[model samples]
Target: MKAGYVALVGRPNVGKSTLLNHLIGQKISITSRRPQTTRHRIHGIKTTEAGQAVFVDTPGIHASQKRAMNRYLNRTAGTALLDVDVIVWIVDRPVWLAEDDLVLERIQTSAAPVILVINKVDRLEDKAALLPFLESAQQRHPFAALIPASALRGHNLDALEHKIMELLPEGEPIFDQDQLTDRSLRFLAAEIIREKLIRSLGQEVPHALSVEIEQYQTEGKLTRIAALIWVEREGQKAIVIGQQGEVLKKVGERARQDLERLTEGKVFLQLWVKVKENWSDDERALRSLGYAE
Candidate 1:
């Protein structure tokens, strides 16, 4: 059987998380339209009769390393490139950007075969441009395979999976057949809350915020969870809380629904907004908030 690890590497908001969720047939990774919504490395495992693919969904690689969080994200994404069986480099647009060049530089250090995935083809206005773009991408790197796919609409993903399985080496499954991800329920719960926050708030506050699960307990068919939403400043906290607590209430409702679906049980979720004073830029604060390397 063919079984091994596959790293999904790309620039910010290039649909890496969307591709991973589609590949595994589950939403193990949180996705948002905003760039840098995904900050952690997550594993979405897919086991079929052919083999098991331990897909590593990483934070998008970007050029900015000015902040501590930015450096952490780049390190996390670069670390995933090592020792993986296959590298699926996803690019949303047909054309490559300077950030894509950044990703290329990192993956060049790895010996594993790379597959260049031109994602979001369904949205491409010039379908005729695909071939020339693919050819240009080929000249840049000796990719094992070049596939045009849409992770959102589930187009050409089957072909991508087939190629992945083919490239994987022969071995026993690394995880159980029924397993969908390596993350714990608590971790996923925090991510769901964070996703809701990212979707609910405007552009300025998403990256400044982080979610921490303060309490998680189960009783019968119900799971009670309390999550802390950490923002960088008091103004951000006020923005998250909103007028008359409307924003926080709405975020709580949305997060609870997803948590219920994930846990297969009723969820009692509580969300509170607090200030951590530029935690994203503070490496010590980041480690305390679960950004440890």
Candidate 2:
């Protein structure tokens, strides 16, 4: 059986996490439209009769125009591409790909073989417009395969999985076949809560907020989880909590539902909003959130 590391490198909102979830057949990572949704290297393992492929989903590559912490996210993403048996360069099929010129150039130089995965095929109403992309991928790079699949719809994922097996070098499985991700359950819980906030609260607030699971304890049929939602400003916290704390309540209820599903037990979730005063700018805060200092 073949086994090796494969990194998913691409721009923001291009379905990297979705594609990774599709490949692993599980939601090991959270996804959102906002850039930098994925800040750490999350490894999602795909096991089949043929072999095991560990897919590493990196944060989207973006020009660091926001802050030093933002640059750290990009650097963490870059680290994933440095060494791997294969690289899957995901690009949106219907949406414009020109914004990723710099990212594409970086992928082009990777020593590992690149596979152009054109995601969002299901979105393209006119399939005819994809020809240029289909043709150029093969001609432009040392691509092992140019696979078109709807990562969100689970189309052609079997083919992509098979291709990964074929390309993977002979080696031992990096992780257990039964295990889906390298992150702990606490980490998953935190990300899930963060995702709910991102979805309900919108981009401006979620980007400025960081989640921490201070207490996670099992109690009979219920799991008690206390999560801190850290924001940069008190005014932002006010918004997060919303009028009469309705917004934060909704966020907590939604997160509890998902966490229960993930943990297979009832959840007593407590959420708090606190202002860390520019946690994104402070090295200690960033480090506590798993971002590089």
Candidate 3:
């Protein structure tokens, strides 16, 4: 049996979360069009006849290190590469960015074999452009395998999985066969609420916001959850609440639907917007909000 950990690392908005979900055949990680949507390192386990592959979905590595939150994200992404059996470096575009250079430098330190996955090939207008990009990538390092895949459209992913299984070391399954992820239901619920907030609000609000589940109780087939949405200031709170609390209402409704689907049971969700006074820049506030390094 081939069983080991696989780390997915890339810049923000490179479809790392989407790739992980498709690879595992379940939604273990939340995804969004916005960059840096994933702050925590999530584990998605895929067990097949060949072996069990535990995929680590990490926050995107970027150039920004100004805020305490940004530093925490970088640290989270960096730490996942330290002890993985294989690394799948995903990139959305054909051309490499300066942030990709930073990710490459980090990967150079890892002894595990790296597979360069070019994701979102379904959006590429010119098919011919990929060849040159692949050629240039090969000159940089001897990648274990270079595969062009679209995680959203389910293209070339089976081949990617085959390569991953081949690369993993021979061992017994680390997790139970039926398990899909390592995250708790409460943590996933909080992540779902945060995803709705990021999708509903403007670009600026997402960076200033964080979600925390203040209370969670499961009674029979129904779950009662109360969550707090932390914003940096009163004005941001007002924006999140919208006119007559429309924005918050919409976010709650979306989150509830997703929560029900994820939990496969009845859900009673309550969300409140509160001011936390620049939590992103404050180290203590960040730790209180679960951004500890």
Candidate 4:
């Protein structure tokens, strides 16, 4: 059996998380239109009759290291490239960007074979342009394979998966065949709350805020959860709560619905917004808030 780790690395908002979810046929990772939606390295395991692929979904590697959070994200993504059997580099568009160069530099150090995936090809207006773009990409690196796919529309993903499995080294499955992911229920609950907040709020607030589950308890068929939303400033907190607490209420309702579906039980969710004074940039604050490596 061909079983190994496949690191999905890319620039921000390039559909790496989307690709991982589609490959596993499950939503173990949260996705948003916002760049840097995935802040941690998550393992999504897919076991088939052929073998098992432990897909590592990582945060996007970007050029900006201006903020401590940005550096942390780059570090998180870069670390995922180590000792992997295969690396799948996903890009949204055909052409390369400056940020793509940043991702290229990090992956070049890896000894594993790299497969270039040009994602979002369904949105491309000129279908014929793909050939020239693929040729240009080949000149940049000796990719094991180049596949044009759309993670959103599920286009050409089977071919991509087939190629990945072929390149993986032969070994026994690293995780149990019945397992889908390597994250705890509490971690996923926090991610769900954070995803709801990101989808509901405007562009500015998503990056400045983080969700922490203060309490989680299960009683028979019901699960009670209390989550704290931390923002960098009071203004952000006010925006998250909204006028008459409507925003927080809506976020809670949406998050609870998803939590129920995930846990297969009724959820009692409580949400509160608080100011943490630039927690995203403070190293100590980040570690305390569960950003530790």
Model 4 scores a TM of 0.99
Q: lDDT per residue, candidate 4, 199-257, as tens digits?
A: 99998999998999999999998999999999999999999999999999999999999
* Candidates in descending lDDT order: 4, 3, 1, 2
Query: Which runs in model 2 stand beyond 4 Å of their true positions?
Result: 94-99
- Could you tell me the lDDT of residue 274 within candidate 1? 86
Per-residue lDDT of model 2, residues 19-47, tens digit only: 88877777898988777788788999877
Question: What C-alpha lDDT do the candidate models reach, one value each?
Answer: 0.93, 0.85, 0.94, 0.94
What is the alpha-carbon lDDT for the whole of candidate 3? 0.94
Instruction: Give all candidate RMSDs, comma-separated.
Output: 0.7, 1.6, 0.8, 0.7
- Any residue pairs clashing in model 1, and if so which? none
Candidate 3 C-alpha lDDT tens digits along 178-252: 999998999999999999999988878898989999999999889999999999989999999999999999999
lDDT of 3 at 158: 94
What shift in Å separates residue 104 of candidate 1 from its native position after superposition? 0.7
- Give the lowest summed-lDDT range of ten residues in model 3: 284-293
TM-score, model 2 to reference:
0.95
> What lDDT is reached at residue 133 by model 2?
70
Between which residue pairs do clashes occur in model 3?
none
